[model samples]
Target: QATAMSVDCLGQRAVLSGRRFLYIVNLDAPNEGHRKISRQSKWDIGAVQWNPHDSYAYYFAASSNQRVDLYKWKEGNGEVCTSLQGHTRVISDLDWAVFEPDLLVTSSVDTYIYIWDIKDTRKPTVSLSAVAGASQVKWNKKNANCLATSHDGDVRIWDKRKPSTAVEYLAAHLSKIHGLDWHPDNEYTLATSSQDNSVRFWDYRQPRKYLNILPCQVPVWKARYTPFSNGLVTVMVPQLRRENSLLLWNVFDLNTPVHTFVGHDDVVLEFQWRKQKEGSKDYQLVTWSRDQTLRMWRIDSQLQRLCANDILDGVEDLIDGISHLPEPDKTLHPQDSEPQHNSGHGDEEALKEDFLNDPLVGKKTDQLGLPQTLQQEFSLINVQIRNVNVEMDAVSRSCTVSVHCGNHRVRMLVMFPVQYPNNAAPSFQFINPTSITASMKAKLLKILKDTSLQKVKRNQSCLEPCLRQLVSWLESVVVRRTAWAFCPTLLSSL
Candidate 1:
């Protein structure tokens, strides 16, 4: 299997591999180390999304499936998808809507909108959109069913009840609208970009012709809604000397530039607020450039990060402010220090049991503080295969990670271009299998065996594939940690 990309939680690592498949590589190092627990590969992953609330389960969109699939591995991974089906056009974007995780939407380049009762992607309870290119879809944070979209040069908003209700229609720009997003706090607010020389915002519920318009020197690439509720962030390509640059503005009035992010050598394709750890002091900004580079920009100040965070009415709120959630619930007005959720927080027995039972959470918590309700099932990862040492064919550019404990041989041929990073030393990485023995493959197979979190099970079944389950795990292997914790420093950058 080939992976176009992969993403993992402190608990489970997922590989978005080709052949339209996803492999869950259970890991422990939210701080310590990554190891494989179990894996199940299914569907052709066009898009894969994790439940922001929990890491064990996830959603994937595929062409053959023609539905949004949900999975939960707790009770032996099976399709939670017996009833859920979404989208008619090879489901494009599937996400637990930011405002409500229960509500799910999927779109295809084919002009159709299918809103499914997330429990089942197998069917769409509501639908909309005309015969046109439906490039993007987004819901108004305050108003769930109200959707805004970009189709060529038109920007339109539709209410669920009246799918035909074009609450706000604008033949806004001459060229295709490339980006559209809504401010979390401001209902009826919309920001969009196109080939036009300007990025514009509109207040649909109001009578204003255009809420505000900021000039763009070049055709804007894409613009995102800033965390400031009503502000907007726009990316544009600069003339010859450079390919592109980004601009941030307060769309509420659009009179002044709040921030300008420069230094990108190519067009910054997209920008997003990397939701920081719930209670941690660290804050980050991410921008993906066409130059095939992902740059991590640390928001210079703590207060600055708070200001750019996605809290409505902001961090001063007594309870609703997400960034300030770790503090006491002023709404309840506790008499002393805020009580945490753990039943016996300091009880070593309970903690030890929790960690042993569910190593995923213990490790996933390395830096990204997890939500209070999160929990997981127990798993032993990386059954270390130390006996049959790694046999690397260095001259052939063949590098692999495997567990060669005596007779068992489970391995993943790694394809990282060895020339990228500084001090890219060669070291053997094992998936942290479990209980290695002389006949390692068989014992490892039994442990690696897994099924889909969804209900549908392919007629095909075997125990061997799990040998090299094709998963990635996280481990607290960092000796001297820094801001860029996960990626190793490349000699090129060194």
Candidate 2:
């Protein structure tokens, strides 16, 4: 049951390994021009990967038992270029260096990791000795010399220049780590999924504490960052052999999965993102399952938005405005630590009492005083009222609402005070192009103010609630006026 697969970096080809052969299929045309190379091997292929560098796009490596065979496929013909033989036990994983085409690293149960130069396959060019065998290995995408290896529940960071010892150690998980992935943009950041039923994000600079954690009920087989936005894809160990275990999460807010991928009849063995094409907003997720089927899921811009943190964009602008000031304290005190989502939020009142105390809102209150929480609310607000149009500007702390109910068009500007959502309400004022009567306007304004006050007293946002109240009242007033006119006509006819 050899079921290893890898897609080339160019996104043009994919190779799937089986017991008797390696099937190479063109991703652009999966059904045609497919070819297979026969290989006689007793052990299953444990891992396979294509060279990530563009120049070496035709080369790939597959490990069967303890030996890794490097294959070259070009012009519809394929053959084994060379084979590396050093590990005493099964090879667990291998990775091609992101920056170096000639460097390939492999981890094995022999408790030795080898960095081989394909030019000389006689033996490994360098060997790293460890007490426990590594289950996974990956090169840092942002740094050429940095790499990481996972041994049981621990992780070791290494610099290729220093092979004598690991530079840093992280006790990442209590259970065995099943997956490790380095962040696309940051070299210091990485994610690990473990059998402990949790995926934890780590900033390796601070090894003691994790940046965040995503807890699941079942063991996680793999968790990897999306190539596009702030999304993460996780494949959980299937329970009962029929559960839908693939889930997509928004890294910033791990409250719920943004989407779930269905249709895999069996467990997903391997999954990888296709290299994004130039000038395209859509992404393709390629997954291979034990059901013996390969599937591609398309992610459009709309679905991508669910994974984005809208508040971060506005917060970055606020941070830039105060660049001249001294940097904020980097030391994270126990009180200022990250709040775990699974734990109760009873103590969160102290940190979230006001916008100024918000962790993401930042300490630059003197410069902009804008709260990122407000921006996030605007992005997620539902504005589907029948005759209402709202224009919200979180930066200015104001929203303009226009409503049309029967010949009356009311336009008002609602401005929030500085102490908003902390027992301070917004002010509502009617603007030009308002065709409503004085009595109607006064009644509507009173209702809006009361709605805002009720929510603000409880330390909650009031913009969306106020808009909904306005629409509900306006519709009721229109119905009453229509009923009065109909009553007079009915009496005259009788």
Candidate 3:
């Protein structure tokens, strides 16, 4: 049910990979002029990608089984131009070089990564072996020779120029990596999502520790950087298989997603950005779901602003506002503007100085050392934790947390002060429906108070962590009681 979808860099068309066919749709008019190319294989396409060059706009690649097919489409006709075959096992993923139109890379379960030249489909031009099969392969957008591959929990960085071994290695995760993405602007930076229920950012140069981590309640299916602003898009595998899980996040503020895209009745299989057209301020996100539907959402300037980093705000505003300014008078002769050119150059320096001096320009940033607001913390809290329920009222600065473990039930009111999470802890009160005794309630209250104090002293959000602690404590209590109740009977039977 998970189909692969790819949008061409030109943004004029998209290709969807299906079990028995490949469907190419005109993005500008999705309901019309669509063509489906039949696949004669039992193996579904594992990965699909469109060539990132404008000149090769009609060219795309799809991987099936151990082979990869290159498709060429023009006007109303489309067909497979060639097939690249070398891997001994199933090919897992493929990617086209961002800087080279003729080059394509494929990774396989055969423990080999092959780089193919479309001009010569007889054999691979270069092959790199990692001794372990790779689940994903991605070409660096900023560097043509650089590529990265994910092998289980580890990542290997490769430079095509030197194919003998990985130039750098990172123990990225403890579980299988589901997705790998290179930063659009930085060559050494990348993000890896895994079954470990977290997405970690890496500089690669310093592999000992991650730059930042985004903890999630469910495994992240994919994490990718947006082409505009300091934004990131993540696809999560929710516990309820078909729940809405597409989220748009600000990279600067990782505590919460800026917006969540809801509407898909089933899980989203793939998503890609529609190339932003010239003179347009809006970007579109195209997604394909397990429900067998394709949906596109427009991201206007207003949404883009929410993802903008404070340090980049001034630059983004300058670029967007330049076109709105009136065009200079072309009627004036070149000789008539000589004095104005000199005066204008002088004014430019003064304007730059004034811009820098303005207090409102590039002065605010995410690292302002301020604690998060109650509403922001509430937005960041995970509501899907098992056997736990939290009802938060931001206006009242209070929340009711309920946890059920075995036959025990706990319902408590957690009230926060005005200066919460800034050396100010919330007070927990056991309420109706609580099944624990007075001694147990007091113990739980002390644990909750200590947990909240630990985080508040550091000016951090503690509500979610405290809730998780409550669940763990209750489960331990239940397990101990069950063991004690059955221990004597087991010994007598023995």
Candidate 4:
């Protein structure tokens, strides 16, 4: 199997592809090396390009036989977690719509490019057949609705919202279009690479035009805009070595190459510009070499913001959970056709006026965006947590979580409203833990290791029995339960 080729960072989590598996690292920890998150994958992690949003996110893989599988990495400890299904060939490259989190685009060797509604992993929402030999794909970041692809000798763009070929070109290239990428900050600016040993830039917004071409003797295998940085491009070339080399490009003047990096002897197979933080242009840079090395690069200078096509060093947090934007609802997150632009200049004022009138704006919400309904049910809690012996029994038929804080002799319960008629009241709930996080869980585990418990010892493989016994004793027992109590109020705050 191929060694890990690329690893992309998104805040604490970094998605790594290689060894026929995906590894996610919550790098935010003080000792991230000790914590590992991984899963075997049925997809080929490309030499460059990791998921743009979440670390577990993956769309399309290089086809081993006939079909490419796209997946959403599920982080819980459960079977049937990872979601997959996409293109029918080696998924050469893919990208997700940023503004709309649920949309995915992919291109493959089968000569077909497709889009998916990751919101529903069961099926592909849109599929558009492309030219034969088409093997590259990239989404226009400036316009998530648009996608571009290159095949044997053509470069094409399609409106994802449309079914027919809205934009096409037969005379776009003289040879196979090997690489394609769109500018991160600008919608019209695009870069293309070819087997003809040349890299070219184009501005699609300007009546279908090619801005400039930079000559190169090597095949440009991958190219992309450095996430969040201004006017920077990182390209991977597999010419002299199977590993790869970094080529810096100036989007304003693509005809001239500014810098070429030569650090690895083997093929430099994968490269990713660290996302987040503008000042850390060169910070968090990562690359894989065939020589079995996954090295990190830090920008040498802080004064210089832009160097070559990569940002300067030390900038991080670009992937820190997209700036908390005022979204209408979760529905808009994955399939929002477009964010409603401020109708007039005083959008700020307009939003303030609207927010003041929104009934659910500042209040705690239930599963249906309504106030949490109150009802009582003292039923069974039967959700099992695998080998961990951690389970969430529906203490009642309602949505209530019982958190056991090992120390301080304290336990808290956050319960939600009752399920309504028609199974359609749609009680709004965030399944993600309220008071507990992965990091918090990890810390508690560490504490368990240090504390006195039934199963305390070295190299004891299973802690389920011990943890279950501890949790059973620590559960908060309230005799009389009502909706108007502190438990319900605290539950709604979550």
Candidate 4 ranges beyond 4 A from true positions: 1-9, 25-51, 54-83, 205-209, 228-236, 240-244, 253-258, 277-282, 300-494
Can you tell me which runs of candidate 2 are displaced by over 4 Å? Answer: 312-339, 342-494
- How well does candidate 4 match the true structure in TM-score terms? 0.52
Q: Estimate every model's Cα lDDT from 0 to 1.
A: 0.44, 0.74, 0.75, 0.44
Q: RMSDs, each prediction?
A: 20.5, 15.8, 16.5, 23.2
User: Model 1: C-alpha RMSD to truth?
Assistant: 20.5
- TM-score, every prediction: 0.50, 0.66, 0.67, 0.52
**Residue range with the least summed lDDT across 10 consecutive positions in model 3:** 341-350
lDDT of 3 at 409: 97
Q: What would the per-residue lDDT of candidate 4 be over residues 1-494, giving only the tens digit for each residue?
A: 34443343354344445544444444343122322234355555553334556634443233333333444334432123334465566666666666666676666777667676755767667877764646667777777677787777577777877756647553445777766777766676677777767666666543244555556666665566555433344554565554244655444334222233434557765666555456553454555556544444433322122222221122231121111012232111112223222211100001222233442454322222211222211111112321122233344433333343333232223232243222322122224443444553444444333321211221111122223322422221110122111122212221
* Tens digit of per-residue lDDT, candidate 1, span 364-450: 232122112111100111122122223344455444455433333445443223431122312223344533334433422322333
In TM-score terms, candidate 2 sits at 0.66
Error of 1 at 377 (Å): 60
